[model samples]
Target chain A: MNIVEKILARASGKSKVSPDDVVFANVDKVMMHDVSGPGVIKVFDKLQKQGISVDKLWDSTKVWVAEDHFVPSAEKVSAENIVKLSNFTKRYGIEKHFKYGMGQYGICHTISHEEAMVMPGDVYVGGDSHTNTTGALGAFACGLGHTDVAYVLLNGKIWFKVPETFYFKLNGKLPDHVMAKDFILKIIGDIGTDGGAYRTMQFGGSGIDEMSVQSRLTMCNMTTEAGAKNGIVEPDQKVFDYLTRRGATNLNLIKGDSDAEYEKIFEYEGSELEPVVAKPFSPENISVVREAPSVELDKCYIGSCTGAKYEDLEAAAKILKGRKVKIRTEILPAAISIYQRAMENGLLKIFLDAGVTVGPPTCGACCGAHMGVLAKDEICISTTNRNFPGRMGHIESQTYLSSPLVAAASAVTGKITDPRDLK
Target chain B: MDSFKNVTSIVTPLDKVNVDTDQIVPKQFLKLIQKSGFGKFLFFDWRYDENENKKPDFVLNDSKYDGSKILVTGDNFGCGSSREHAVWALLDYGFSVIIAPSFADIFFSNCFKNGILPISLDEKTVEKLQQETRPIEVDLEKQTIKTLSEEISFEIDPHKKKILLEGLDDIAQTLQYEDEITEFEKNSKIPSVL
Candidate 1:
């Protein structure tokens, strides 16, 4: 069995499992944010009406919460949701509630790693689709809906059909100008939006070994765009060292057997990949940065769980250090910890010197919830996932998804510019 | 939860592909606490203009689909966020069934949990279903969709079929196996990462 299969089999108390086997695997960790937290609360209310116990979780220690999506409370409704979440957490005694303005709060996916909320060989689930981001640590992480998450909260287990694995092997290190965001975009373009639907996308080979832990996170984060069940990398020393730094201990790394099977194997030469962008309305529509359509981009957003990691910010700062942005730009770090790192490392000063606005760590415009959303007919170059209609505000507004380097370079010139092409 | 059975209704055709969750129920309306009353917000951007007036060009606004309980659309429906609000909005909007060539994983599961039956058919068959102007009958027990021209069969997991047919509460059903779950917890190598 492969890693995902082994994890599911172990959690389900089965000796062996294969693709298409339905198992109610025990959940090691579960998460819900401001958006899904309130949604789950609603589910709990409905379940209580049916006489099922909603008084406590199966294990409060296994459950964590985040105040992303609509934090800094954009308005009354969102503020009320936050209060409701606080009351819910207080009543339930969930100690790991990461509240906004209370230190350590950030996007749920970011907090998953920055705080080491998920560990290797664990089955982690969150209410947000980007929960797959934590799979970089070798956990079997996947997203669930409010009803499903609510069920997990009450039962500590949920059913999943073991997904067939699609292995992505990258040869050699990526070019300096290219990043994991670019490679994942190219993969998504090749496989269309529904390419990996109901399956797992696993990364490996020399290029993955050369990549940083955060870069691996970026790759797994966007697997949702391709409709994947989860994205993962085998946990190695890099994962162990990274997690250990974040205070993780007793790490039990999980890997597939020597003869483990993959439904398909797709290989890529890392040196050949160029910075790419996914055009508006769909994440599968891709164009290399140099050949991208020339549009008068109105904003350049460098934020989201998909982007805005510490390394992502360093990549952006590398381009913005001595330049000024020609267009409106914002660089919101994904987590407060990343924000502090950016400050300590002078990335924030470099961004401010480049005439960019750095906002607090909130999901904000990434989910089209608040802070800096686009206006009607506006075009944006964003280092965020999902460019669907009205995703970042007005339905008419257009978004071009790119790597942090491309977005930063574009901010300097007000057009989609390759990092190497920047003057 | 209502046990889903059969529905005979005019099919609402959304001709676009990748009908994402954000488009289903725009982000602004997600803050609302309740699951019901979201029907009005379903496809908000497409159905309404900036001033909140109904857009005449969008399909949902057409009087022909006013009472549609079934929606037929392009491939990769509900492809973005894992927000169940999208399914809630669809269910609240009275859509008991959705037919497409494919669906994103999370949104597909969200549909069944909320008593909404999502059907996946071939693209050509879905395109045919989309163009049907008359009401079509969807019988869940038989797993067949009856149109004027032919009867189309669909595949659904028997466990999921049982959930929708019996309106089984997922949590309640799991509680019946409490002993097994407790046994697993006692014997499993459960890690305390936190």
Candidate 2:
């Protein structure tokens, strides 16, 4: 069995498992944010009305909460939702709630790794689709809906039809100008949006071994865009060191067997990869940076769990250090920890010096929720995943998805400029 | 949750692929804590103009799909986000059955939990159903969708079918296996984490 297969098999108490086999896997950790937190609370309410027990969770310690998506309170309603989330957490005795404005609050996926909430060999599930991001840590991480999360809260387990694995092998190191974002976008482009549906996308090879844990995270984060159930890389020394620095201890790494099976294998030469962007309306609608549509960009947003990591910010700062942005650009870190690191390392100052507004960490405009969404007919280059119609703002507003480097370079020129093409 | 009743209605057709949850219920409306009122916000951008006037060109505004209990759309419906609110909005708007060529994995699981029956059929069958102007009958007991001209059979997991048929609360149903779950936990060796 592969890493995902072995993890799921162990969690479910199965001696062996195969793709499409249904197993009720015991969950190690679960997460819900303000948006899904309230939704799960509502599910609990409905369950109570149905005469089911909603008194306590199976294990409160395994459950964590985050306040993102509409944090800093998008409005009175969102404010009330935050209050509801707080009350529910207090009532349930969930101690790991990352409260907004209190400290260390940010996107749920970011907090998962930053706070070391999940570890390798754990079956982690969250209410948001991008929960797949944490799979980069070698955990069998997947996203669930509010009701499913509500179920996990009470049952500590949920049924899953094990997914077939798609092994992605990268040979050689990525070019300096190309980042994980470009490679994932290229994969999504080659395989349509539903190509990975009900399957796992696993990364491995010389390139993955050479990549940083943060870069591997960026790779897994966008697996949601391809409709994958989860994304993973086998745990290794780099993963152990990354987690150990983040306070994780007693780590037990999980790896695939020598005879592990994959449904398919796809290989890419990292040295031949180039910066790419996903055009408007679909993540699979991708084009190389040099061949991208030449349009005036209204905004450049460098934020979201997909981007805005410390390394992502460093990449952007390197591009923006001695250059001024020609458009309205925002650099919102994915977490307060990342925010502080960027601040301490002078990445924030470089962004501010480059005529960019350094904002607080939040899901923000990535989901079209507050904090500088695009207006009608506006165009943007974003480091966030997804560019579907109305994804970032008005129905007609367009977004071109690119790496932080490309977004920073585009910010400098107010056009879709590749970092290599930047003046 | 309501038990699955054979639905009979004029099928609403959304001739678009990858109809994401964001469009089904946009981010702005997600602030509402209650799930009941989302019917008004379903397809907020497509169903209405900026000033909140109805857009005549959208399929929902054509009056043909009024009170539609079944929505037949292009492939990969409900493709983005794991929001259950999308299913809530669809159900609140009176949709009980959604027929598509494919659906995003999370959204597909969400439908059964919410008592919405999402059926996957071949593209040609879905397109043929989409073009059917007459009211269609979807019978879960028989596992068949009957239009005026043709009857199409669909497949579903027996367990999922039983859930929709019985309107069983998922949490309550799972609790019945508490002994099994506890035994699994006791016997399993879980790795330690930070």
- RMSD, one per candidate, in order: 1.8, 1.5
Worst 10 residues of 1 chain A by lDDT: A47-56
TM-score, each model? 0.98, 0.98
TM-score of chain B of each: 0.92, 0.93
i-RMSD of all predictions:
3.4, 2.8
Candidate 1 accuracy as TM-score:
0.98
Tens-place lDDT digits, model 1, residues B1-194 = 77887999999999988889998999998898698899999999888888999999999888989889999999999999998999989999999999999999999999988899999999999999989999999999999999988899999988889889988767766777789777877887633322
Chain B, candidate 2: TM-score: 0.93
Q: Single out the weakest 10-residue window by summed lDDT for candidate 2 chain B.
A: B185-194
lDDT of 1: 0.92
